[model samples]
Target: MTTATPHLLPGTEIAIESLPKVSLHDHLDGGLRPQTIIELADAIGLELPATDAAALGAWFAEKSDSGSLVEYLKTFDVTTAVMQTREGLERVAREFVLDLAADGVVWGEIRWAPEQHLTRGLSLDETVEAVQAGLDAGVEEARGAGHRIRVGQLVSAMRHADRGREIAELALRHRDRGVVGFDIAGAEAGFPAGRMRDAFDLLAASFFPATVHAGEADGLESIRGALLDGRALRLGHGVRLLEDITLTEEGGSTIATLGPVAEWVKDRQIALETSPSSNLQTGAIAAWGDAMVDHPLDLFYQLGFRVTVNTDNRLMSATTLSRELALVAEAFAYDLDDLLALQLNAAQAAFLPVEDREALMDTLIDGFEGAL
Candidate 1:
């Protein structure tokens, strides 16, 4: 089910979509298919801005490109509206995985805030169960279709909500079932990771891992809070971490100096889950410039930081993981080796046992070698 028009690596016939991929920062609510949204909305007696699938899809892409996170987030209202019921959630989750499989995502961590879907009498645990059920079905469907794919849930809590502790507990309850990790996502400006100290304390004490949404809508302090307070092993949309590095031109060569925060992230190999198209859309990389080439991800990669490419919201950005990689490859002049390196970075940073990670690396290496 790959796209008819392949997203190829620049100057090569290899379709990027055929490459094995690991997606670290995809949102569940943000990746629904347009026709699915329309059908789900119709079932719930919900009115949409557009009844046509293509038109509705265009609306989301248009609204998301507003270059303001808050404004961009407003599009979620339509998507989330149709996802309140168990049937809606299950269908959306199933389709999400199938889509990922078609795009060559071998492993993906799908994240969403349970609290947002509680308005229709579904408890947090119930919602998690529903999504897991759908994910399990999706995995089976993919396997039956001759695709090698796996997915895990990363339960997230909305930062604007005061239910951090509650959401953390919910995630822990289902840790053995399907949930792999926890996250705090929403507006990252006023709601620093420190606001959820008690929740992080609980997770830290229990040896649970978390990735905080930082260095995107906010700046260095937000990233500092994510690392120091949230105990984040990964920084979600951490594009702005580049601000900590001072760049200089010397003797016709560029030299970069890492500030304390940058040093800690780089030294510790904290994975930066960067989304190139979404970063430009949400203005996450505005300080650098307004194009894909201006994204700090290439700089981070060149600087030896654990840089991983992701499609933050495929529907919103009108992109796929393959398209994101192709865009980065085109912008940064990356070849197959560079693309493999980024996927290896993602596999290494995955929330899996060390043995599993090593196996994943081997899978990636085999896939790349076979492609060559």
Candidate 2:
């Protein structure tokens, strides 16, 4: 299906795309329009596997669905190739916001590593500024179209790279200029958050919020590092925390026993930004199973963990926030209240200040209530 096509869940006449939503884990590089990628590649003289937008999109889905993280990441080479230039980055970021607006996202945090964009002669700071410009322009465009939406940048540093400190400083510099928070995005397995202690410390000194990618590619130890060292305000795709929970059959019903890590996360209400399709694609949930129904999101939710749904890579996973929600709703048999609880979890865990977060929660509650 095309990116514009709305995928409704079974038995729900209400289009999922019409429900107000919040997207916290979407990537700027991973949300590029296939048609935009083709044109941008053509503009920059880059070769692509498929010239047609539909075929190119299909190619991305197939590659990502291979259940190999390395192969899945290779798709970004094409998307990032087209996004190297200023105009490409601007256009992509602008369109990312517009697409999220269309998908009923009233607020979103678009995360990408600025260090990755410098291969085309742009400095790290310049890249952040360019993305900010695009975001501002997109917000204006959305307003012109009578869609009220707000987006912020989550400047991500490559965890394996040595430039974490620089990227953290860049985020701090741009904190008031559209950059909302800091993150470390790439290669979560070997690169623990402790490895970027200097960057995390710098951000901490500035009292900045950070969200680390943990429990997706790696397991509980990585999550430990994220909480202890990275001081992460949220866990990006932290689905594997379920591994620490032991389910025991007592009588006929099942009872969940939470390990220390899982208990800590649950007690603290650390939001798990679980991306269903991307989790399946990257084999993050391979230990659980291959299908969306097997995802640990339901377990976490049932256990009273702060569970929030996300689209980690929209282009690669070929999903929107609404689509991801619909998929999970179909698999777990969720109603509007379940969806609202997820949105409320996201709003509470949002990087916004307390007052703004309350406002967002109010907006979500009112929106969902009106729809009901």
Candidate 3:
């Protein structure tokens, strides 16, 4: 499914890859290039299931498509294994940006847990600095290539671990650098955001923004903790929040009622970073259905919620932001206006200053207008 050149949508005769986009929930460890993974593994004397790039790429997709979160997460072990050193982190970060720029991403936020990459004797601060250096290099390279892209790091803490406070402090220490926000990621079923209340309190005290991973593997209660306890500004793949919305058939029309949790999220316009492909693979939307058309994205959009499209794990999902947009467009018959709305939603929710967000909005508008 990998291509050397851009792919075009069949009927529209438009190159979706050429449209400017924003990526909000992308993962650093989950987006490593297959070729880079092979090379890194070789350097570390690690063995992989497939030595060839194409086969290794296929392996990741197969593992992720098993429809089990446990199976899906196993692929990350391979990717993160090679990302334990400064060189590996820098290379992966730089190439990740390059790939995003090539896919017409104008702005993106790359999230990863710093604590996960410290196995090779690198300090948390060193890991962040190395990733920042790589991101800076990639931005400059993209600029030189006439592709303007800006990326910020959203430092994440593993929910199953006890380093939320340490990771929150790490993010704040690098706030003036490339770090923009904080997040808690990992299995969300058993580990509630309330367990990390101290870290969230520290972040709230420091006035740092956060976007917690909730409502994916869990239900409404996890989302509740994310909002009330974690104080998350955004909900990563908050697709399961739909459980709080009750659809009633009355008078030949289906009426949807939002529970308090869903109401708060919708009323506050907390952006839902919905990744259709990844959601399907991980069964995040299994309650709704197994197809893209069955995703609650349309319902969320129709309800006036901030529903932004995202490619959560490009490598595992074997997808790009443009491909994701195309899938949703095909499923819901979204026109150019819908695409622009999603991009605008992401721009507005970005963890950037008002001036920077406005500047990004201008660029997105100009890009869409030019595409038209």
Question: Could you give me the TM-score of model 3 versus the true structure?
Answer: 0.98
Q: How many backbone collisions does model 1 have?
A: 0
Model 3 segments more than 4 A misplaced: 5-10
On the 0 to 100 scale, the lDDT of residue 107 in model 2 is: 91
Q: For residues 76-116, write the lDDT of model 2, one tens digit per residue.
A: 88888887778989999999999888888999999998888
Q: Which candidate has the top score in lDDT? A: 1
Relative to the unseen true structure, what is the C-alpha lDDT of residue 130 in candidate 1, on a scale of 0 to 100?
Answer: 95
RMSD of each: 0.9, 1.2, 1.2
Clashing pairs in 3: none
How does each model score on TM-score?
0.99, 0.98, 0.98
Predictions in order: lDDT? 0.93, 0.90, 0.92
Cα distance off (Å), candidate 3, residue 148: 1.1
Candidate 1 weakest ten by summed lDDT: 1-10
Q: Write the per-residue lDDT of candidate 3 for residues 1-372, one digit (tens) a residue.
A: 234656565457778888898999999999998999999999999999999998999999998998777679888999999999999999999999999999999999999999999899999999999999999999999889999899999999999999989999999999999999999998888999998999999999999999999999999999999999999889999999999999999999989999999999999999999999999999999988999999999999989999999999999999899889988988898888888899999999999999999999999999888887
